[model samples]
Target: MKIIDQNYINGEFKTIDSSKRLTLKNPTTEEDIAQIYLSTPAEMDEAIHCAATTFESFSQTSIDTRMDILQRIHDELHKYEEELIDLAVLEFGATITTTRRRTKNAINLFLAIKEELKSYDFIKKDDYSITIKEGVGVIGVIIPWNANLAHLCSNIAPAIALGCTLVIKPSEFNALETQAFLECLHRANIPKGVVNVVHGTGEVVGEILTKHPLVNAISFIGSTKTGKRIFENCSKTIKRMTLELGGKSPTVLLEDANLAEVIPHVLSSAYSNSGQACHAGSRLLVPKAKVNEVKRLLLETIQKLKIGDPKNEETKIGPMINQTQFNTVQDYIKSGIEEGAQLLCGGLGRVQEFEKGYFVKPTVFICQDQTLKIVQEEIFGPVLCVLPYESEQEALNMANDTLFGLSAYVFSSDETKAYEFAKQIRSGRVLINTAASKAKNPPFGGMKQSGLGRMGGRYSMDAFCEIKSILF
Candidate 1:
């Protein structure tokens, strides 16, 4: 078994002194694969101090110097691409295809941020005064287990570009993968104390990062509940925060949309990352007249998805992260049945072939009630709720009814109509007909309770910066 007993602090990995150890199992085989010694409160404090100390010099780095660091980090990560992919599959049961795509995207974020920094203006001068942007000092990053590396790189890229230091707290479930990522950073020769990682439960490491006064800002990617708690905790220090929280995203199929072409896109959004994504289009909105056709297409498409082994190239869906997640998915499935929603396909229980593991059946339900728990809550599993609407306005209303406004999808043959409808949905990103964005550096974040601030491109640069006005 892989034993991870160190925390990456300052310029080196230090052995953790805490006796608290977390054993991680392969979600696919239910076999122990790694054990990690959790970081104690004292260790977390040391990491924060290191970052804070480094910020005094790191924050003054030139743009060209920071860009060079970003490039080097990107290259180092690429060297470990295959190892990271393997760890992702073994540690969290992610399919190889999904792992490769996410890993590539995560690595590319650094290059993208480097490109953004090339032409970025740090200071703007006018006849009266000059406005300058400087790094916001030490940043605290809290990442979730679903896409831990992606979140890590995404948050780190911007901090590096803006010459800010970081103290990261990654989820304990993916220790091996996190360790591999830290090794890459170490090999890249990043400046001492510029980036540090602490491994532990949220109650210990996460709380310290959020409440510490030395941490000037925070960037978090997790559930809304945790985000709210962090928000409350950060209030004590009045830290600048950029929160990328939960989502119950909607996929709306217009009357003019071709069901054959659109059903695949809908399923891709709904079930991507085994439906464990914050931005998964878990709520499907369809016209009342076409519910039958949509149902037929959905049932037909779900059968073709392979759900056994995550390492297999053919597997599109994989097991839940652990028994707790598996039980949560099962509970949601039970609620769907007890609430009187029609089970369109895939009921409770694991796939018949798997006697062990945390695999869950890809379930779907047809329901019109918007208040049902299955329809309203964020079930982070391969389960979808289909809601039928009478008119376009009703569809818009239904899509925006939830507490989340992270992402929304609109499908229509008429581009103008889809674009118009997308504008009305209250979300950070609204994709017309594609599962992924075609834009190179589109800003990403949510409105309302979904999040507090944005990340990506110039928005990320701004989030990690503090502005000052100098009088002429």
Candidate 2:
């Protein structure tokens, strides 16, 4: 088995001294793949101190210099594309298609940020005074495992663009993938102490990053529960924070929407990343009259999805991250059955063909009750809950009833009507008749308990910056 015994700190790989180690397994085969030496609390402290010290010089870097670094990093990422894709599939159980798309998107983020930096104005002047936006100093970055490299690159690009130093703590689950990414950062020739990584559990490494006084801001993408704890911890120091939390996003099909055209889009959102995405449209809101038609289309589409080893190019669905996640998805499916929701397609247990691995049946449920656990909670699996609404007003109400407002989808033949309806939803991003947004560098975050601040484009830059007014 491969062994990962180093943490990237001060632009160098330092051997981890802690005895605590996490063994990683291939989600598809349930076989041990690698063992990672976890970073200790003292190591986390060293990373933080390195980042804090680096911020003094890094934060003063010129925009052109920072842009060059981003470009170099982007180029370096391209060299590791194949390795990154392979590791994502082997470790995270992501299908090849999903891994390719995620890896591509992650690499492109650096170029996108570089473009944004080209014209970005760090200082604005009026007749009376000049307003300055400076890097927020040492930043603490914590990311989840669902899209390890994507989250890592996403968090890193913005902070780098703003000339902010980072002390990042990625999930221990994707330690191997994280190691590959760290190599990319190292080869990019990033300045010493500009980017530091600590590999350990959240209770250890994460706690230090969250509570450290030297860390000026935090950029985290994880569950709502962990985000809450981080928020509370940051409150003690009153640090700037940008949190991208959980979502139980809704896919609304208006009465006028064409079932043939829209059902494909709906299923894409529902099952993207094998339904492990935080913004997966797990809730499907349909007009009461169209429920039957939607159900038929959903089953027809789901059957065509190839579920098996992630290594297969044709495999669309892969196994869960591990036994814990598999059990969690199973529990949610069981709750749906016990709560009286009709299981239209798929049910409890693995696919008949697969005897091993954490593969869950891609399930769908027809439910009227919005209070059901399957309807209300973030299942983070290939499970979709179809909720029928009698009226458009009711549809809007049902879509916005959840505690999450990260993302929502609206499908209608009438573009104007769909746009109008999308505006009323409380989600941070409302896509009309599309699973993905085409807009460049649009703000991404959520309303209500979903998140506190935004990321992407200038919004991300703002998150890592401190604004000041210099009066003439």
Candidate 3:
């Protein structure tokens, strides 16, 4: 198989003119995997121009034609399932199980979006009034390294279904995976200039796409800080923006909840994707009476999780994206210790056996209260802060205390109580006795500083569209 080293523009794979390139390395083995040719200023402009020009024709394309293209893309995605999984494992240090599941999920997400398009109403008429929903125009998508494939599909599928053209800026860390995705689109015979991928630093290529007058909308998935910058650039042109930013999501366990059953779900929610997820349940709010029992159960479960080589099928936890991410996580651990949070288990540095990879232990800390840094900050790692609350109202308050309202969870034997509590929670999506990730294609996003707008299913199509009313 030939490694794809060029940028996709105008339905063609063109060589990047820049001497600079991004060298990708496997986080698990610390070995070089592939290289992505960095986009030159001219190449970046070409992509934006291609997409802006394509939108004129693409935005008028018939719904059936767009739907067929989506189906084709869906079929094309599965054809490279194994290859995608391998790339994810190598470049992302994703465990075999996680890579397989997330890859399959990413492929199926297109199919789900296709199904949504079938019932979605692009044009509606009632008596003398006509309402139309159309694509927002040329969209610039910036996806993060964590869950890159699924996140890309979440944005791109809807953009295409709504008859919009796009230029994607994938995380440099997972350039190979993004290249595979572009190849899938190319194989699907997507119309030329409809979808393009550019590789380079966010400061350059990202800034260009966001600030370009030709680009009409921006869909960004990354940290809150970066999202704000993107928002500022988009605001200059008053462009449409969809941002899925950071989260310090909380998981609240009620006093009546059984610690044994809920602890496993809590642990999985916090540690999945090695806790690199934006909506990770990093803060665990437990009843004060059950803190000791929760700690004991958490210890037992953490011991069972295998943390090592991502190639191993049994590995549940994998390394951070790179050394910088590893050090960031370690620094957060140090801060938790310094701030007087009790280290219940697992703390600091690499796992003893693995001296080569950027791995960190599945750490747990018992915070003195919600005021602690570990409880308040978005530590995107496998570090869980257990905060004990005195009452249900207090738990709800603690969960809503942060600036991030991305996701929240409540576990209780009583569904009514859980549902009632979930309603008042400040997050965009609330899970009752379940992890925050199980809802597929339902409305997903956040409130407050978690960023504006939503994604998933019909909500996604609506987000990418502009509504107009014609009164007759």
Candidate 4:
């Protein structure tokens, strides 16, 4: 098994005081693939203080210098993209196709932030008022196992581009992927202590990093409950925070929607990363009149989604990150049955041909009540709960009922109606008439529990910044 015992601190990979390390299981093989260091509280403190010190200079660095660092990071990451891709597949239990797509998308954000940074004028010396968008000092960047690469890249690249330092706590499940990427940062010769990567359980190191005094802000991507705890902790110092939290987002299927195209898109959005995304369209709300039709499509769609070894190019689905997640998904499936939701297809247990790994069959539940516990919660798995609504207003209410409003989808032939529906829905991003996801251009975030602020494009850069005005 490969073991990584160093945490990137003060611009270099260094070992901790003790030999304490964390061994993470390969979700696919159900065995240990690697071991990563778990930082002692003192080492975490040292990392934070170092980042705070670096921020003094980093926050004041010229945009050109920061831009150069970001450019180098982009270049180096591209060079190691293949290896990173492999690591993501291993740690992610995601198909190589999804791994490549997400990894490339993440690396692209470095370049994207470079362009976005140009739009952020750090030192404007106008007569009216000198307004500057500056970094928010040291940031604690926390990521989840699912979408590990994309989330961290989106948060950290923007911080570096905005001239802020970050202490990253990658999910223990994929420390290698995070380490490999940090290797690129180190090779970029980034300023000392500007970026540090640590690994451990959230209760141990993550708790310390989130509450550290030297940490100025927290940019977290995880469950809503954990986000709330982190938010409350940061409250002590009133540190600025940006959290991408939970989602029970819905995908509305209007009768006129194209079942062929829209079904695939909705399924992809619902099942990608095993539905672990904050934007997972876990709820499928269809018009009551077209209930049977939508159900047929969803049933057929979930059946066709090849779920198994992520290494297989033909595989469209894979296992949850670990057993805890697999069990969580299993319990939700059980609850769906206990709650009396109609089980159209899939339940507990592994895929037929592949039984050793921690895999769950892609489960779908058709329910009567939109308020059904299964319908209202974010089940981060391949489970999709199909719900039928009597009218458009009912569908809209069901979609907006949850505290999470991260993402939603509307399938309709009429563009105007789809646009109008999107306007009424309280979500960060809305897919219209298709399952295809959008790019990093427009603003993305949630209205309620889904998250805060937008990521990608200029919005992410905006999140890492603070605006100040100086009157001449």
In terms of lDDT, which candidate is strongest?
A: 1
Q: Local distance difference test, per candidate?
A: 0.93, 0.92, 0.88, 0.83
Count clashing residue pairs per candidate. Answer: 0, 0, 0, 1
lDDT minimum window of 10 residues, candidate 1: 434-443
- Error in Å for residue 154 of model 2: 1.2
**Predicted structure 3: lDDT:** 0.88
lDDT of 3 by residue, 93-165 (tens): 9798988988898899888888998889988999999999999999999999999899888888999999999
Ranking by TM-score: 1, 2, 3, 4
Residue runs of model 2 more than 4 Å from their true location after superposition: none
Residue 176's C-alpha lDDT in candidate 3?
81
Model 4 Cα shift for residue 29 (angstroms) = 1.7
Better of 1 and 2 by lDDT: 1
- Model 2 worst lDDT window (10 residues): 435-444
> For residues 202-314, could you state the per-residue lDDT of candidate 1 as single tens digits?
99889999999999999999889999999999999899999999999999999899999999888888888888898999999999999999999998999998998999999
lDDT of 2 at 181: 88
Instruction: Report the Cα lDDT for residue 157, model 2.
Output: 92
If both were scored by TM-score, which would come out higher, candidate 3 or candidate 4?
A: 3
- Tell me each candidate's TM-score: 0.99, 0.99, 0.97, 0.96
Tens digit per residue, CA lDDT, model 4, 240-349: 88888888878988767877778888888888777777777889888778778877887787777887888999998888888888889888898999989999888877
lDDT of 1 at 382: 91
Off by over 4 Å in 4: 123-127
